[model samples]
Target chain A: MRRGIGFWTGLGFTLLISAFLILPVLASVIAGVTANQFVGLSSGLTTRWLVEVWANYGGTVLLSLRIALATLAVTLLIGIPAAYVLARHAGVTARLVEEALVMPVAVPGIATALGLILAYGAVGDLRASWLFILAGHVVFCLPFMLRSVLAVLLALDLKGLEEAARACGASWPQRFLGVVLPNVSGGVLAGSLMVVTLSLGEFNMTLLLHTPFTRTLPVGLADAYTALRTEMASAYTLIFFVLIVPLLSAMQWAASRAERLGR
Target chain B: MSVAIRLAGCGRTWPGGSIALHPLDLDIAAGETLVLLGPSGCGKTTLLRLIAGLEAPDAGGRVFFDGEDVTRLPIERRHVGMVFQSYALFPNMDVAGNIGYGLRVRGVARAAARRRVDEMLAMMRLDGLGGRRIEALSGGQRQRVALARAIAPRPRVLLLDEPLSALDARLREQLRQEIDALLRSLGITAVYVTHDQAEAMALGDRIAAMEKGRIAQIGTGRDLYHRPANDFVAGFVGDTNRLATPEGERLVRPEHLALRRSATGGFTVVQATFLGPVVRVLLRDAAGRELRADVPDEDVPAPGERVAVLFQGRSLETEAAASPA
Candidate 1:
């Protein structure tokens, strides 16, 4: 069959949009590998900038990874049960508590950081550690985790399933592990990936909370941009792409899988 | 083994003070099958949940299983098997896993649980489908798996909450027969809840017809069919036509009224539809009130024919044994 004008028009628009979004990232990566950013790709690509960035800033990358995983762990530990309780009760008090948990996401990140610092800055040791950065990330990421799991739990026949398990002689923990957790595993996975994704790229709050010794990837990227060469900064962006692109894809895939299962 | 159940002054009221059930006493003998029959919002399910220990009665209410008070115990300690209308089978598990879950919860050994699961699969006529996913089964097969899952641990009581309502008519009838046989063979105290009168009649040793949070009547199917306690029970348990007899208003089933062709009769046959063994005849009287009569195929009457409707069962309302309340 012959293609129609509508198909070509749609194809043209899509290509235009893709180029608009992807061309800049491609240009940056190409410049990072090139011998020099000023001469562009014709100067020949080299791994010199990449190696230099890794040598000087690799600790920031590892620090970010550690904080992201810790954020995920803390969210999973507290958020799943919180979401379950919130979804099941669904009273005015539960709704109010959910709104309070989500307040961090709604507030400006810098303001949230300020609030946390003022509240706990007197603890000198905690303030000077990477754990301070992690605390900020958790506060920002917990809302997403709660929303994801809460949506799944609400869509389920939770009461019926629990009652069925109860009648089958399953104790409280057994029912939770056997019936509740497995049913919402998809949501939990999606939420975990999302928390990690947000924590890795978190900048505004992390900037305020991080000490010089506790600097994260995003803070290091800012340092590379403002205080280092252009090619080194682009190399930092490339490193970030390497770290978080696959995580974003997995998060999208997991969310869609959860949606399909809900159907 | 079986258990006798007794509920003394069991009632339920929501937090906002809406009554779901009135304070009423009920007793089910050991190995008895009592079906709670009602329409939507009639509290039949609430009554069943009270017995299953999934719900608690109001103040001063007590539930006894084999004369042991269990009102404060939750459902997990009650050893009751419950089958839901939605077939709440865990989707993550296969058919065998679903059936064996209760067994494993009871600390049954691995080999014993597997063997019991197999026995339950065979009993439910799902022997070869044990490894299949819950989503892969049809509605009837899923409900059968739910039954197997509930009864695998051999609980003291079985509670079914509209277990066959989701299936088509033919499948429902087939499953109803299977459940009837299962209940009889198990010899376990069972409480069945459904809005379907035919299902209650077929499976219940005695059916409790509920209306407005009260037990309108509780009796055998024959007793309820032949002698309804009130208008609500009369209308609920079977199809009935209210007739303005000289003895005030009388309730009569279609089979109880016989039609005879009479040129001078005040009623005329509006239509006759063939329904397999029994043909349903619709008639309109002089006052335009409608009546129906179920007759054998050999006694077919043409539409628009004048006929006299006769009360065949009570014969002018003389038998108190077959009278309406």
Candidate 2:
């Protein structure tokens, strides 16, 4: 017998939507990489604009990497504990805390950036450093990271492992670092990858608060677009694709592995 | 090498005023495996956790390991090993790492830990499977791994919470025997929790029958089965047909009721099922009290046949309405 109408229809719909969304990005990226510079779609392969952008704005690209890495580190340090506590601690207080953590996800990113800028700018200190940008990125990404980590943590057999580790004479720290962390490694890695990708591509906050030294790749590309350089902007987008694709692919693979293990 | 564990007036009540465990007094002798037998919500697992120091009891409760007070000690300091019902082997670690975990926690050298793990694996009959990942192991294999992990550190006490409940019937029976032998060989005091009375009887030196956070009876398997102190214990320890009397109660086991060919007997067989080795006869008395009698398969009566049933004289005694003061 057939596997039912819903199953085939679902698969067909998924394939149709995936092609609809992905084909355009693929075609544009290819054209951006191949078209001759400044002539848009003129014949022949030419990566000359890519080379120039790399040579000139390599520093901005590295800054983006640093920002993304810093954001990832900060999110993990804060979000994991929050997620773990939310998952492990029982009672109404934990429920309230979980709800509060989820509130950030409901807020629009542009509004969050605006509020963060206003709040930090009101302090009138450290407004131009990477710290401000990092803080903003953290506020925006904390919800996703916490949600991701906490979902996995909630699914885990926490009490069982904790009891097993304690029975083994493991100290509290040893239990957390050895038993607990290893069990949630997939969740933590997934959260870190999310923060990295989001922070790297973040444009709203960076555009509102970009400086000479702290210009992220997205902000730099926006600035190049403002200057009416389509060839250059396309080149910058190509550069971004090159840098983000590998990390995104790696994260996707890790997530899929975790999902497969679960299945 | 028998160890003794004592709990003095132990009780636990949650914050919302729900009692998880009521005041309990128990003495488990060394080299004996005591199974706490009860149904769901009976707090058998809670009692095991309390003694293991995974949970703390409220005021006026104390636990003793070898006559030393350990009521307030955290689980790590209690020197007790607990096997979870789910087995809870660290999925990230291979079988060897999981078993050696306890040793590594206590600052044992890798060489020594591995050596102990090797012995534990061999004891659990998992000698060559140490390097295999826990996820790669079958359910029975994982259960053995969990047992090996708990016993590797050689703690003073071992607490098992429904350790064999996850296995199929054949595997559960086999593992139950192996586990009993292993516990006997190690001479470690063990408190096992289970809802299966058969398992409790087969594995326990003494069985504690619990009901609603209180111990109904604690005695040898024979005593608990043959001489249960109350209706709850009587009905729990075996298949007891509780018959209401004018004064109090009478509980009779299926084997205690004899089926014979007589019209003057207490009851007549209404139906009979030939259950391979034994025959089950359902009978109804003059007062319409239904009783079950188990007879040998060869003597089983046909459907709609008449059979006489008899009960021991002492089985007619009525149980007291109230629990012992």
Candidate 3:
């Protein structure tokens, strides 16, 4: 095919926007390795800042991973069945309930966190525990999980599939395990990735919910940027990317696979 | 082995209080193939679902399988096989896995299930396609897999709900013949539902014609066509014209009507349509009553010509309209 002016123009515009989005991350990567970010790249490159950031915030990184995994598990356990019910019922009550689940996503996460703290703050055990932050992460990440699974459920002929299973003499539990779970596994995979990504990066809720000892990666990154040098903060950002890029790539792969499957 | 089925006062009313099927009784002898024939919303599907245990009947209604009460049983416990119009094959499973699912669910050993699956694959002419994915198959192949899956477990009864309605006309005819052969070979009691009269006539040993949640009539295809109990059945079974006679309104099939040359007091030929073997002639009388007659193409009269309509066989009275004198 022959090149056209419009095609070149659109390509140039897309490249320009991509550069605009990626330049900041590239600068951070450069700064994270620089011997002295204040003196610019000509000074030298070294891993000293990265080593310092890891030594200072390694526990926070592990805590973030723990909280993200917990959030993923809890959201999936509750969201999948809730989505199933919402998909099957499809009445006013189900609609209202679905909207209520989405309320956390629509409202600012800080407000939701504040509300949770105000309601449960009286209990010292819960308020001081890492599970308190896990609760806030679950609230923030659940809507995405439910929405993903519900989208797949609503698009499928699940009721017909269930009926077919029943006619084959499968009990309810057997049908759920054998038919429903396999069919919705793609949705569950995509949703789990979303939950982990959101929970790992979540700051607005964690800012209000986290205690000094229960600090997550994002909370620690914020504290490092404010209390430490710019190079240390940039190194923390690089580490965050290292932890999250694989999950993002897996999500992309799942999305394309679902498209290929025509679901 | 096939089991006889009996429904005593079975009916269904939707949650919103709309009657989907009125209370009715029906019986199917062991190894019989009964087709429920009706247009959409005529309650044919509701009756089939009631028998399948997918829907419970209204109070005072009961369903029996081999004279055992199964009214309270759910579909999972009913032990019936069903084929749906959409073919509802598990997309996650391969053809062999889909065919073997029922047996596995019934706690059959893995090797035994594999044998049954292979047997079904051969029976349905799906050899060499057992490992193929569902999305890789054609519509006809998917339907064949659905049938293989349904019958692999050898359930006591088979319920097919418009299974061929999704296929093209040519494929529908082919699969219809295949289904008829399979039913005969299995000798399993089956309840087939369809809106196509030709399909009902071809596959059913007996057909229960339903209308507005009620059974209009039940008989063999010959009985429904030649000796319909009422006008609805007469018109529903085949092409028919109602003619006013001294006795009353009489129903005559287009095949039975013969066109004759006449001057007046008969029908004037309005149009002639040649359809391969026979030409259908449309006629109108002075009373403005219209009738269609299928005559030999060689003897077709041109439009605006006058012809008398002759009844070749016995004309039926519209019992729905009035008593036959």
User: What fnat does each of the candidate structures reach?
Assistant: 0.76, 0.84, 0.69
On a 0 to 100 scale, what is the lDDT of residue A97 in model 1?
97
Report the C-alpha lDDT of model 3 over B65-129, residue by residue, as the tens digit.
Answer: 99999999999899999999889888878899889889989999999899999999999999999
DockQ for every model comes to 0.56, 0.55, 0.57
**Which should have the higher TM-score, number 1 or number 2?**
1
Write one digit per residue (lDDT tens) for candidate 3, span A153-228.
Answer: 8888998899999999999898888888778877888788889989999999999999999999999999998986
- Per-residue lDDT, model 1, residue A60, is 98
> TM-score of the candidate numbered 3?
0.96
Ranked by DockQ, top first: 3, 1, 2
**Deviation (Å) of A49 in candidate 3:** 0.8
TM-score of each: 0.93, 0.90, 0.96
Residue-pair clashes per prediction, in order, are 0, 2, 0
Question: How does candidate 1 fare on TM-score?
Answer: 0.93
- Higher-DockQ candidate of 2 and 3: 3
Identify the runs in model 3 with alpha carbons over 4 angstroms from their true place.
A247-263, B321-325
* Evaluation by DockQ, superior candidate among 1 and 2: 1
In angstroms, how far off is A173's CA in candidate 2? 1.2
- Residue A70, model 3: lDDT of 92
